[model samples]
Target chain A: MNAPLPAAVDWPLAVHQALSRLGFGVIGYVPDAGHKRLIELCHGDARLRTVVLSTEEEGIGLATGAWLGGAKTALLMQSSGVGNIVNALGVVRECRIPLLLVVTMRGEYGEFNPWQVPMGQATPEVLRAMGVLVQRADTADEVAVQVDAAARIAFGGYAAAAVLISQRVIGIKSFQEQAAQ
Target chain B: MSALRRREVVRALLVNRGDLLVVAGLGSTAWDCAATGDHPLTFPMWGGMGCAAVTGLGLALAQPARRVLVVTGDGEMLMGLGSLATIGVQRPANLSVVVIDNERYGETGMQKTHTAHGVDLAAMARAAGFASAVLVREASAIESLRQAVHHGAGPHFAQVKVVAEKEAITLPPREGTLLKNRFREALLGASASLQ
Candidate 1:
């Protein structure tokens, strides 16, 4: 287990540093508000390639491909994206592909929208059922630290692991909140 | 011209393969690739339904020096049509995706796929901005496809119409881990044994 980086006290910055330190070759993600800052940070650094995916499930295949080509990879998505990843994870699991997923929660803890609830609630259980190790992070510092630890476990042993950034830490989304951007 | 043979098209593409990395989609395409000859560099998807193209895309992006090819059926290709859009946006010059369009789901009792009803996958790929998108209905044109796939500067796409007939089920090694590790070892050498 790795300790939280000095930058871990913050948020998206902390998560970004964790991925950077691990030397991830590729980062696959769909458009996500919770992951917007992190995704932007990972883009075009020369150290890694951040791919814009059509769907979350595509990220699973992308990660698998990267690994097979001797490159390390990770996926960033909202919990809703986890549902799209259900069948795709079977490839990663059965193939023993080293994978790390960083997911941001949307349905719990001050969720303004009800629709995100069903899939968000099922995210962890769904991943666990698919033979993925799940670790949830409730605080800003915990999120990146867990991502780093999970990545180590995954890449070290050719396993799949995910760090779910809890909704509380990711901040609540509302129409008014959208007013700023 | 009538439909071409699936195994022949796959065999033609893989003849002097050299260093081309292949990702075969589930069902018949996998069997077709296996029917030719099993190799460590060729990953036949026993499970992932529509991921072969994107999987090849990932490899293409990672190893920009190596050409990656994806062989998938029309049904599997249709299932992940969104991947074409994604590939279009990325446009890795080293990737080529070929759909063995039998117009039917050969593995599942020959149910007609979208291609059977006049769906043009090559046109879709062209719209998706592939450098080369051709619907190969003739064996004579396969030489050009092989040239484009192996040597052209492109994210290429070709939907080769094939006869919807069953071939011998040439099953490759089904163990995913072994397939993965062997591919890694072949591609990455000692580094594969490490992580």
Candidate 2:
């Protein structure tokens, strides 16, 4: 038999299964390369409904609505998208809605896109300021654990929680790399 | 066909609302909803101007057995215009969006919005792949719009044009948590506690 896939390659599946087990029926997101595999799994799952958002703030709204309707939901976004969600985060904080934000890091280590730096660097702080409990995971093995913790903090407590997956886990996509492709 | 009054349209829309859950955008639309008499089923945004439609989308998806209606003003709808594309693609049949288009930002001192400058929201909804979208400028059209809001096969969009006239504000509960808990209790009953 072929060798099992590496943990890095299998982490997306772990995250997906974790979300399903935690009872999240909806996944809302803006398109991001770092989340491609997770997004694909969300789309493929028969039990989950994937919502492609025009802006990340819309996902915040979706999460609030899902909570009121007694359904669980998660948001998957890139760090830059976190800036777009700041004002909308008020609903989650003030209303005490349970929210899970899975963010993929950029501009953290060996980042090529200069435009991503400001927001990426500010993401954790911004989320914290908005009253979101923040957790970081740098390796594939850490992802499932962090996600599980986040879900408990979010759903179990009716609070906002974020799991920021480091770029080291997603890999650095340099400008040169894109040009080569 | 002349534009219908905003308050009249809102009243008629909620006339036979039944078990429908309503999400109202900030400013005028929120006041309009409150004017209809507050209920636990109606969630009105006191802030977060552009979030109403997507909120309805989430409610629709979560409660497929229930109808979710979003009532928003023209300016608010313009601010969250991208949501139409998302809603169009998701196509939640139980959700409907109604834009009370006065063509001006009433809360911002009657500043003209994009709708006044030839931005057609109904057309945008149609182009974004909404199952059905219509612009209603006449009072006669309100009945058809009401039917669509309550019973139509939707993911529908209706732009109900109105005259830009200011009215006395009718405010809902200011506490977000209170409003949220009230709505949750109404919808989920004893299971409203988040834990």
Candidate 3:
């Protein structure tokens, strides 16, 4: 007898739900295709305040302010945006402010954009160098667990933590796919 | 209208401040805030240049009942111009951003900034959708600015034009950890370290 295929997991929805469960009242983000569902979910939720950022660095400031005001907050961004936020991360790390970053990875596993590779490969190390605890989720099933753990460590411990969602889970966009579109 | 004195302007703004959390940008603005009086609620950044306004936004969002003010310089405000738009959309009523437009980068030896080239920060803030955005060129207009900072329904933005001149530096506590802890203690009291 043939076994049934496992159910397809919706990682974005799962992550969004996890953030809500974790008591994040504010979500600051720069738009990315990988985060479409999560962004939509946040926008529709009346309890959550969604902020669209022009640069990733602004999200850091927004999250910092939100925390200071006694609200739990999260920042959502793509890996490429990580480069823009290194300096701002100092405020979070040095001040011992709790922060949750959900980053969608690019330039790995059949990536078409060469520009994204350097930052994508360097993201974890960069965050680590800045004193952020880094966690990874390669499969859809791991999304909720990793995000939940990161949220706990960040808010409960008053420290910075990041959950990097791999490109494989987000479905890598190849050059051919872009050309076809 | 002649440019107002920054030190006096800052002092005036904070004269009646009560339970207000302040996030000061680096250099001159930080010094101005320190000169007024150091309080546990004051968080003065030593190096984070463009993060002050957003930092105030976070503090305001975290404590909706308390007012959060961000006092920053022109160069710093230009560096973080995008923050206005973010604040515009979020519209945190308790948050206010006051940009001290000396029109120069005072820390870097008085180099001219974009504001000197006629950049209108208040207009930018207005365009970005702040509930109230004003330019305070005259000292006579300060009372309205004060009202906006303290009791106005906002995300308010104000660009206070001041003469580009050096003043005695009044540095606040330098240790980031100490500042953070004190702020947390002042806000959360005994439960600050509970987490």
Candidate 4:
């Protein structure tokens, strides 16, 4: 078990550290602002290989392939992206591939975009419906902890698992946020 | 004179394949691979329609030293078309994607795929920046295809044009987990678990 993290923690860094320590070779993503820091951390570290996917579903396939080839992998995506992997997740469930997903929420808690609601609201149940074990981390302190646990369970049990980092933790994206930058 | 037979093309590709790891796409390609005498190194997709190429990409990325081949159908390839862009970017030299383009969805009542009309998958692969991409319409070219798959510096893509027809069912083990476990064991030996 990993030692308890400090109260004042950079959750992204914490999650990155946990994954690195667990020996994940590949990090697949569709690029999400919520996971920006963690993605950068994995990319910067030589220990991990970063694959920027065209869509979220590719990450699951990537993870499955990497695992079958004897290397561990994880995926990073936004909550709405979860809907994209609904059918593809079958490969993991049927094959018993160990997949760890770190998703940033979009629809709930100070949400600005109406389009994100349907899929984002359906994320957890959708994942559960696909036979994936779901874990939620609504706060920074819980983020790394959930990731660590989820990854352990996924790999250790050879099952599909996900850690959903609440949008409250990722912070809602305002329309003007990027325009100002 | 005509498109190739998928089973024959798959058999030609697998002849004395040695240690090459294959990620067989769902439906006919999986059945085609199984038809060639199932091997522990081959993971035939029971589901996940468009995942074949990226799965091969993942395997290629993971096992850099081992040659990885993805054999999928035209429809499966078309569905995961974006993966060509993704693969083109990473460009794992050991990976090769072979599309069995009969230009029809064989399992789904032989509906015409985009290739049956005008879409050129090989051209799409070329545009995606694959190191080597071609459309193979002759069995005579398969010797070269085998060579490229077995011994080329490639993030290669080959669309072997096959005559779309119903093939006899050659089922591999239906249990997905066993297929995965045996493949990992064959590749990683005892270390499959530790990693």
Tens digit per residue, CA lDDT, model 1, A1-181: 1222244476778878888899899999987777878888888467888888889889888888888898888999899999998999999999999999999888777677899889888889999999999999987877887998999999888889999988877675576774554
Best by DockQ: 4
TM match of model 3 to true structure: 0.94
- Candidate 3: tens digits of C-alpha lDDT, residues B95-120: 89999999989988999999889899
By DockQ thresholds, what CAPRI class is model 1?
Answer: medium
lDDT of candidate model 3 versus the reference: 0.86
Which candidate, 1 or 3, would have the higher lDDT against the true structure?
Answer: 1
Worst 10 residues of 4 chain A by lDDT: A1-10
Better of 1 and 3 by TM-score: 1
* Residue B133 error, candidate 3, Å: 1.7
Candidate 2 wrongly placed segments (more than 4 Å): A1-9, A176-181
TM-score of each: 0.96, 0.96, 0.94, 0.96
| TM-score of predicted chain A against the true chain A, for each candidate | 0.92, 0.93, 0.92, 0.93
| Tens-place lDDT digits, model 4, residues A46-110 | 98889999988888889889998888899999988999999999989988899999999888886
lDDT ranking, best first: 4, 2, 1, 3
lDDT of each residue in B4-42, candidate 2, tens digit only: 899999999997689999999989999999999988899
Clashing pairs in 2: none
Give the winner by TM-score: 2 or 3: 2
